[model samples]
Target: MNPETAKPATAAEHFFDRELSWLEFNDRVLQEALDARTPLVERLKFVAIFSSNLDEFFMVRISGLIERERAGAAGSAPAGMAPSQQLDAIRTHLARQTALQHRLFDGELRELMKQHGILLLDYAALDEPQRGALEAHFSGQVFPVLTPLSVDAGHPFPQMSNLSLNLAVIVEDPVNGLRKFARIKVPDTLPRFVALPQGPDQAGWTGVPLEQLIAGNLARLFPGMIVRGHHMFRITRDADFTVREDEAEDLMLAIEEEVGKRHLDGFVCRLEIERSMPAELRESLMEELEVSSRDVYEFDGLLNLRDLFYFLSLPLPELKDMPWTPVVPAPFQAAPDESGEPRATLFDAIKRGDVLVHHPYHSFAATVQEFITQAAHDPQVLAIKLTLYRTSGDSPIVRALIAAAAARKQVVALIELKARFDEENNIAWANRLEDAGAHVVYGVVGLKTHTKIALVVRKEEEALRRYVHVGTGNYNPKTANLYTDLGLLSCRDDLVADVGDLFNYLTGYSRQDAYRKLLVAPLTLRRRMYELITREMEHARSGAGGHIVAKMNALVDPEMIRHLYEASRAGVRIELVVRGICCLRPGVPGLSENIRVISVVGRYLEHSRIFRFKNGGADEYYIGSADWMTRNLDHRVEAVTPVEDAAAVHHLEQVLAFLLNDNRHAWDLQSDGRYLQRQPAEGEPERAAQALLMEGARLGEF
Candidate 1:
């Protein structure tokens, strides 16, 4: 057999389906809920997380596939699955996972909650006094907000908003001997779980499903009609959209219009109905909603388990994991002098050397937020430039920017209004910044600015020095407490200059294509990454022991995966810690024998992106905002900075080591595209990476 005449492997032979891989990640989330070792309330939280994740997946990924299938798009996914095929596979996989989810919630979690004195009751379970109390409460509160739309000849079928829970009611008119169908949307403003008044013997918290309460009181909603029955249902719509920046005159207005359309005009992608819903009513719903049978899901238990989040708010500390408070890094803590006075500000600490902060372990407010706040108030600061992709509702960072503008400091904010599901929030922040006299630009055309960067220029003596903050997550302090992220505060000359140039490119008419120490996407990032991988391949061929370790939220670029596979064939050892949506098929016999992939899903979302390459023993480390996805590397404006500071690089190395050594909360990806959770063997001490990090942060070891 001639080697040159042999055929090459297709992409389908080398990669896993992207959508299925994402579902597997969510399955890991459901696994957390099934794991009895986890605290009871924490397991409930995981169930809610899983539900929310599936909602978004349908709204975006599944919706896109539906559209492609309708249009008969010819392009297939990298895994060689067409849109229709992927849809079929997704439905099959999702049905099994959702069945498991229902079993865990109904058969296990609910029973366990009862044992712990927590009650999630139905309307039928409420006692006489409790029912009387709820009737009065409903009449006063829920009745006024309820609007039941009757589906008759006069009124066409009412449009259901995205993810709204509703009751399909059948009421008979006794006087006319006629029946009518109506829809009642369960108010989102009201709590999904209505608390029940405790009896003398009841010891713990008790609540009833809001929908059940509505179902029990349908006669109140229809005074003169004979109420038949009501069944619960939910619908998910296509919430994904694209703004044509070239055609739009105003980017912000365009984004706002798209967001408005998202709520009212998205096509229904999924329909969820209870098993009790009659076949006739179900078919009517399918017809009116214009959803096919393939998209319909029947559940034996609750419709939307995302409402399980309500349980987390109960003051049952015994059934929850111990709360963690992010600590201020040692450098950021103002050390006292002999006179008991503070030494210096956050800027002063950065001047000495680079300061590295890891969130959910290190405090975001003490580090990144403080950096912006002090820059806003500092008189010597000449200008502040930052990129706003996503932030909190009551963002202190935005307030500081407004304060800087009020103080007559030069402020330039590159607000990205096209951030998915965050367009409205970003627009509100952009308008506030513009009204405050800060120059707010909607990033460069044809690209969503996904970079996390901030530059502060200050005047010291006769010279102007620049300070920069580069991170892997958004600037939202709220999410900073729930996500594992990394940020670097530096005043180094070359890195700061690069960040300043990147800001110029974002806010002005600069076609800057290169950076000295930073990797800017869509220009140098992809090329540089390929070069790095190729260099490792060369090193491996030369017997120099090539090695690479990368941590990110996803790894979906086919070219990048191919490069990694080539390096693996060259004897380079590659390890990937991707938190979600990894398409690479690792640990194959010949294709990727030297590569391994693992995903970590736990208490905190692993949101940081770190890349390490052992360049013939002279290692190179980077921490930045770009993943290996094509959208990140080729379509979005992203930034990745080298951790040149020895201390910062060492910290990143330690983080990678912790992630790789983790036995708990980590799942190894097999060549067959299955994820097996890693568990400690007998006599092996438990090593949970996140717990270890928390301990280290408390001891100030990081």
Candidate 2:
């Protein structure tokens, strides 16, 4: 057992290892799989999510350890432990979790399948009738796609691609009668779950793994040979891409080409051949993958059950979550003109003053999409400038940009192609944007342009007015319908001026020195936030009302953490709604007792960053793209804008207060790292924050 996993008998390390912290988060996700309250289908989705998360960890984190070991840079993690120490810790934790996963998943899946009347057949479980049917289907469909390669003097081992599941088969020739190793790649083009032919189970619901069917038909695949043994396994390789800027003549093209090759990365992790398999076959697989025993995990039943995600769409309504769609906010639902229209035209609302939107609760399609789509074709709109980090693979936002460019409107785009996993999508979008005559710029060299800002230049009779849309999340409509984020559409002079300068910085050669209404990072975000919090502390010391309320994804930056502690000591009541990794030790004697930290993990991913400070008699409110983490505050180019509209500010506080009061889906953080799940105090129903708000948004229509 990992030291981190064990409950300390005494006062031990106050902090958990960062890697262990991540694993704890993963465990929380796995907990959702076993959560009886969750919809049955959603629970299965969580299992798939857990598998996907672990796969990425092996590709990035585990792969990094291997790279460090190869380069003799083993003492990499800052905790002072050697690189080997970290790797050993990782292996121990993974082994424990893997065992737990099998225990939880196999049992739950079996019970769920029984309840749903859907069975997944295994090779031996199938009768002669089923075998005959599978054979006919295999010959017609699966055989054409099958490619078998034998390991002899003729074949040097082929390069194994990342995330490919394959079989290690042992076959003996009838004539020569010498056993040889053969490899059969699982055809990804074919569906992982194969439906049976001419059965009630097939017509309604029931399936078998393609691997099981292939295993049963192994003799047919290898004619004039006897299949002694075969085992199913998978290899997860290092998919992290590294490209040298100096080598690329065109950075965009080079990045796209490199991204295409990322699938064929170095093998780093392996899910093992079954323990029931022959020792020689297992040994052969380990040799081929170049993995140690620690790197290989063995499961009792299935190899890649993550494919169960496909079964989630099995047309079992009772087994799935109640269908829910995003709600349009009350303000927008009310007729804008008091006459008739689909709410208000977004531009007119911004022209009226500022409009703030909270997504999933507020319809993203109505608010943000309308903002851009309106501007794209509006005759009064002169130019549009937007910063895109990551959008969905297919986005209406990109279509709006193209339309804006087609209208001969000057469209400037700052496309950040280095957005980790979304690099390829961004690269493709950039090329399309460039070809459309839109002024497209790859973001800053050192810092990622993470600021979600949109500038619209429009003619308003007397002069050209700049209306800016600043947000705490991406412009991706899909995420907007799932993530709790804030978007402010405003035409304030100071904010519009700052946005104009930002556009100049991104699209032109101008260097912006200072922003009047916004605090931007990689330049001025930290100092500005520090000054705001310090002012609140000063007011609290002077016997003025002082309070600090912030909502963010994580709170891990040391400098900011110390500042928060100082504020807590100065009699400033701080409420933090952090959804993930928090290193700050709250509720400590003489340290941070006034500081209250709670995390809300529910259906929607809490992604927005909001900061509210009570400055003497006046209140200061801000919404931005940056979190309190170091990477967001100091390293990335981010934006924080003031919520100047009185109505908008009122609305922001309305929701923030509700989230703070939330007990259900909220976990209170202790002085140590443990997150104590908040249960209902009395026999009252749970106050699930997201669900309550969603109901509010739904009922707000009244």
Candidate 3:
């Protein structure tokens, strides 16, 4: 059915809520754990990922919402919800999701343990011998780091740091006929799980949670004082930092100082003792944390489920999924006798002509990093230009850039300071780049240079020819191992010209000019997409094979969504593979019935952004760093270059076909914002996009 074949609607629903849409994406990720075909331990990891994702959502997005509410801002939620109304809805849904999270975590953990002959013991469940061993472990390892606080006429409430788990203790001095409140923060340095020494009554390889261990050791810390009761709690403070641009002489220095000070701030979210706790103790916690009931969560397990990641790394291979290694592209990693050693050299290959690499299938290390490394050290290479957004700790790209700069070769690196949570690392890289005599720019004020592009200019035979590498993912090789991204290596003059222009626009004098072959953000990407959509509308009206295929990390731009809706109305065949955060409602009558959307979640992250627009019979292909989010298309700097290489275009199209046809890791979008997996038909084959690619990679190696 064509996306444009929707029945007409008399009334229309507003755009989907961005926050709720994000939550749904997370839900899809969580559903992976329920998939019986996915390895049990790997399913456990999905649960880990879901919890971690939620923790970040609260720390950043929810924190922002709380701040807005406190400021009495009049902004409505992205889906037409009033600020207050959005908050209420968000909290209610979050509570439900968290409840689901609790069940999945507990169930998966129990299953893994049962299969592996390991056990987790609660305070009440611990046997005498285990209890004795735990007490000893607590005394030796945990008690020294503990700090007990008492609330009395002489002492006020104790302070807690953001996300710090503390025990709210209610003690009594029976002799003095007095009641007291005390607090002890579970030390951050201590591991959240303590393995107990097995004794005669051992429930094979049993362990206790760190919080419970501390609860048991409460008497040891406050000896001779009647240890009444203690309840576990945690606080999440406002993480937003404020730095005045005008006041700072050096922006990096200012950010560094401000980042240091952010540790101390007002409470943003809190988690308190889940079960029955004294009202007085709860009230005291509220007063100390300085937050209301909405900020608090009562949980059954631990205050920070995020810490479960530590235990999730069980190292029990049998309990885990089949481990598979990333493969280098056959063209690059093929045997010297088979594919020629020269084919492996990315720089030489690109200098000779151009090459396109699809990552995870093709090794990012051998492609993106190797290209940079060769450019930096090559005697033929005279200058290098690159963009740095996010990379690993021991990044080969950074080392190569530094080596080039130290060797007196021209190296210019644009480090985006506002990369969110990676600000400090980027600043560190910026300083290193600057110290090595490489020209480092913080990009335009308020605009993040999110484009992943690099240009290497070498004096080839007295005239300079440009070697360029552009991608849909960051230069970070670590993520490249998991994220499905596409990159191109070319000395193509037209592509070179556009990339050179883009680099100059970021680092040197800003050139307000039209890009020749690249669709750049904050200028023409959105306009070009709008025009393409219009062209598709024209083609559909002309009775041609009008179609649109787009793969992106998110689909949340209101205008872009509306345009897709219009294209649906115009009789265009639209298929979207949005890996996360899709807001456009598909399969609705008269709205987007022509539009079909699916999300693929698997071992490898679906990350590359590729779009195909059918201009009657002829199709145009584009791959880029930008998603369809408003920030990418309107606020941040991004680039999408057309894939003109016939082989490359075929490659991208095949990938799009795979994702669209996928069933095992794919979930179809319904009109009501729910993603339902397409049930496999009897005698019909299973299709997992990633698995098929991995098979292709294996065959390519042969």
Among the numbered candidates, top lDDT falls to: 1
Clashes of each: 0, 1, 7
Estimated TM-score per prediction?
Answer: 0.98, 0.92, 0.92
**What tens digits encode model 1's per-residue C-alpha lDDT throughout 136-238?**
8899989899999999999899978999999999999999989889999999999999987777987888888989989888888999899888899999999
Model 2 has a clash total of: 1
Using alpha carbons, what is the TM-score of model 3? 0.92
Off by over 4 Å in 2: 1-15, 74-80, 197-204, 270-273, 334-344
Candidate 3 per-residue lDDT, tens place, 20-56, comes to 7788888888887767777666776787788778767
- Cα lDDT of model 2 overall? 0.79
* Better model by TM-score: candidate 1 vs candidate 2: 1
For each candidate, the alpha-carbon lDDT, in order, equals 0.91, 0.79, 0.80
Off by over 4 Å in 1: 1-9, 199-203, 337-341
Task: Give the TM-score comparing model 2 with the true structure, all chains together.
Answer: 0.92
